[model samples]
Target: MSFTFFTPGPAQLYPTFEKHLQTFVSEQLGSISHRSQQYRDLHKFTVDQLRTLLNVPDSHAILFLGSASEAWERILFSCVELESFHLVNGSFSKKFYDCSNALNKYAHLFEKPMGESFVASEIVVPEYAELICTTHNETSSGVQMPVAEIHKLKQRNPGKFIAVDMVSSAPYPELDYSLIDTAFFSVQKAFGLPAGLGVWIVSEKCLQKAESIRNQYSIGAHNDLPTLWKNALNNETPATPNVMGIYLLGKIAEDFNKIGVQTLRKETEHKASLIYKFIEKQPGFSTFVKEKANRSQTVVVTNTEMPSADIIKHIKAKGMVVGSGYGKYKATQLRIANFPATSVEDVEKLIHELGSL
Candidate 1:
């Protein structure tokens, strides 16, 4: 039986994943050395594809790392010298705040309830905080901050650096990269690929800031922004990287490119609207995020009348898996991802089965 995963993050597999893997092994992409010209070509190809796909600027350096969590650590340690302000909305966003604190920076926050988003105009950032962090999508709660709100934040605080966590929301609701200093995501979610790869896009300003403080303290060995920036200029990493993930991502990105981000965005909106409509009509379930505008276009979280696990089991029995609630809502909420790889037909089928239950 084929299982379709609706759970967020490492959710569904890209439709072309199998063919790409077979070719990956046949082409021996894994065996190539990091320093080889072949590896450089692969790296450059992926970077170029991502820059075009994500509308990334030439001023930014694209680096592949371990995970989004690692990117969180690097961003805080490298970009901020003393303090960083965070717009915390859920578990993942809070973690970024905690990460900066763990590194001994004075991290301030304007925290909101889960499934709630911030009012960008109402936020007051401290003058001392060097970086302002915001999660573009709170995967755990399915709350999405609008692009206009982020632009407002950037406009209000021109001097402060902005870092956005687009973990589950990238490749849709396209961002104007000029407003933010950096953004990062793991391919496991939106890209519909296997895990273990995190893409970090950092602007030139981040590189200069890190270099200025490089002698003051060490953020990390090779993964530091300065090193990642220096090495990426040559289409390389400071260490042996995820060659396979990079290749798969580039190929998958090419597929998204062919389809176009605007088309994917429309498809995402359509699928998400269907799921939300079903939630409203269904007696046993309700959309988690109260305000429709704050609801995430990528990760759709619903509150079930019965325990979420039972609902998950009910869905799983049919060879379909939906995510259980995250953190405190574990038994009461379920997360569903409407990523690029999940087709409209598949989503309609899933909705049909869900309605029957």
Candidate 2:
């Protein structure tokens, strides 16, 4: 039996996803070569739709990659030569810092407890650090770093390149692209598409940085920033990409555009408010992120008084699926995705089921 999915990434598919996928398969769009004009047109359409939906500036180039995880490595490799700084609050943010360390860069972090948020005024970037990384929404902890805080951070450190990991909160954070040097998100999350495609948004300055340091280090060969940017100008990729995923993303974005992003954002907030308000009154359950201001609107995480597995099992039996906690909190938390694909009705049903328990 098919069940409604509220799992964060790989969550419920968009409402019209099946219809679009059927059209894609029947047309054999996937058979087109990446270099073919057909594929280029598709590529340009997806990038343009995303740019319009997300308000990405012309100065920022949109490049498709393997996944958001890959984008992390690309950002570190292409932008930072020696030093980088990160704000670490949860698993995803910590992993970005780990990527920097694995790349042998001098990565420094201002870390906090899992559910805590960062304040821009308190953050101090090292003088020699060339890049600053922040996760717009911490999926694991359901904590979000406010866009204003990110802008403030940029204001304070005018010279540092700011890279945002919007993996689970894309198309939701109304980020002023000018304030950030780079940002990325995978389609599997907010876009409600199957996993595999990652969209990386990089500023002109970041591309120039890659060019400046190309001769100094092994910044990557094929999927490097310079290479990706060069091909993106022609609406193409350096290697074969997930053509099906790209097409579906464009169609879904077009759907989002028709509905208006502001309307979607407002609806997302309405659904999130229902979930958060339910958590407030639900006995034996509490929000993972204590501060209301820092909670994620896209992924709502809650601490359960009972074993989360039992709660998950109980909910699953009723034909809806939610995510268990990430990492160590696996048995004690519930992660409910409040993505654009999940409607107010879906959330209401999930809440009704939770209320019954």
Top model number, lDDT: 2
lDDT of 1: 0.90
lDDT of candidate 1 at residue 177, scale 0 to 100: 81
In candidate 2, what are the lDDT values of residues 289-314, reduced to their tens digit?
98888999999999999899999999
Error of 1 at 31 (Å): 0.5
Instruction: Determine which window of 10 residues in candidate 1 has minimal summed lDDT.
Output: 213-222
lDDT of 2 at 50: 95
Candidate 2 clashing pairs, residues 3+ apart or interchain? none
Question: For residues 1-357, could you state the per-residue lDDT of candidate 1 as single tens digits?
Answer: 788988797888999998999999999888999998999999998999999999999988889998989999999878998899999989999999999989998999899999899878899999899999999999989999998898889999999999999999988857788888999999999999999999999999988888887788677785888878888988999989989999999999988899888888999999999999999998898999998889999999999888888878888988888888899999999898899877888788788878887
TM-score of every model versus the real structure? 0.98, 0.99
